[model samples]
Target: MATVIISALLFVFVLFACRSAWKRQRNGCCGNDIQRLKKVKIKGDKCRDYPYRSLLHIDGMTCQNCARKIENGLCSIEGVCATVRLDQKEALVRMKRPLPESLLCGAVAKAGYTVLKVDFLPQSGHRSL
Candidate 1:
């Protein structure tokens, strides 16, 4: 009888864990950050010249979904567009004008990720780490 009770408790614990995971997934890790990104409008490009670009090294991404979340979050910034590579754990961001490194890092942080490094990629020269 004790064995049966222990088994039942184990099952309940497993179920609870599953439900918690599902909730986190549904919320997309950083729920408020995702929502804020969704509401942002893409700023129009006034200059037809070259766009400023940056490369970001990120951490704490477990899957492609995490990459997508970061991409979406960064893209929401004004005058910014991003491409995230899950395998590389990096993001290439194009911006209409130069933006502060802190802003870039903050966006990733809001998405429940860490920005390990930010590199400026010049259009004519090699990347600056």
Candidate 2:
């Protein structure tokens, strides 16, 4: 009788785990059921307005919602505009002034993503009028 009870408990535990996994798969890996945030628009007349640019390779982004979350978080910072590419798992960030890599990483972290690498691009030749 004890062995039968133990087996039943084990079966119940497995069933619960499977249900949780199915829910996650239906919602998303992040398990965010709420609607996605709106895209943030970069406020600049021309690309030259943002002289500094960086490419951030991020991990733990499983869907478009995750990408938007990271993009919105980065764009909320002053002098920063970010666009996340979900397929590439990277974000292209443009800033009016140079921002420290730590700050960029922190912003991504706030959105529950990990920044694996940050590559600062050289300033382009375009000059703002």
Candidate 3:
């Protein structure tokens, strides 16, 4: 009877601990808060043209921090700038020229994530004649 009581207490304690941890994660302690997204600034010359754009789908992102890490990693590549959307699990990358998908995948991998796939979004008003 005493053993059963002890086990029940332990189970309750563990359940509460897990609930607390989950609440913290949902509250954005593990990553950037969604409320702070508007405050984020990427300093670059917007007037400078980027002719190529690609969308990267990534996995293993638990928070905005993961998205930021992947963005920073991709931006480190020459002539590339990236904006990562945590809600969408996607990164919109703009480049001065086209680059191989492996390069982008490697960047995500280096940031401790996996690239599930990449898709090129059609550019504005450029249909095949």
For model 2, residues 44-124, the per-residue Cα lDDT tens digits are: 555456889999999998887898899999998888978889999999888888999999999999988999999989875
lDDT of 3 by residue, 1-129 (tens): 999999999999999999888877776644456655442344575512566788898988878767777888888888887888889899888776789999999999998999998998655332221
Task: Give the clash count for each candidate.
Answer: 0, 0, 0
Point out where model 3 deviates above 4 Å. Answer: 1-44, 123-129
Residue 93 lDDT, candidate 2, scale 0-100 = 86
What is candidate 2's local distance difference test score? Answer: 0.85
RMSD of 2: 3.6
Q: Give the C-alpha miss distance for residue 115 in model 1, angstroms.
A: 0.5
Q: After superposition, how far is residue 122 of candidate 3 from its true place, in Å?
A: 3.7
Weakest ten-residue segment in model 3 by summed lDDT: 120-129
Q: How close is candidate 1 to the true structure, as a TM-score?
A: 0.66
RMSD of each: 5.6, 3.6, 5.1
Clashing pairs in 3: none
Comparing 1 and 3 by TM-score, which wins?
A: 1
> Could you estimate the TM-score for every candidate?
0.66, 0.77, 0.64
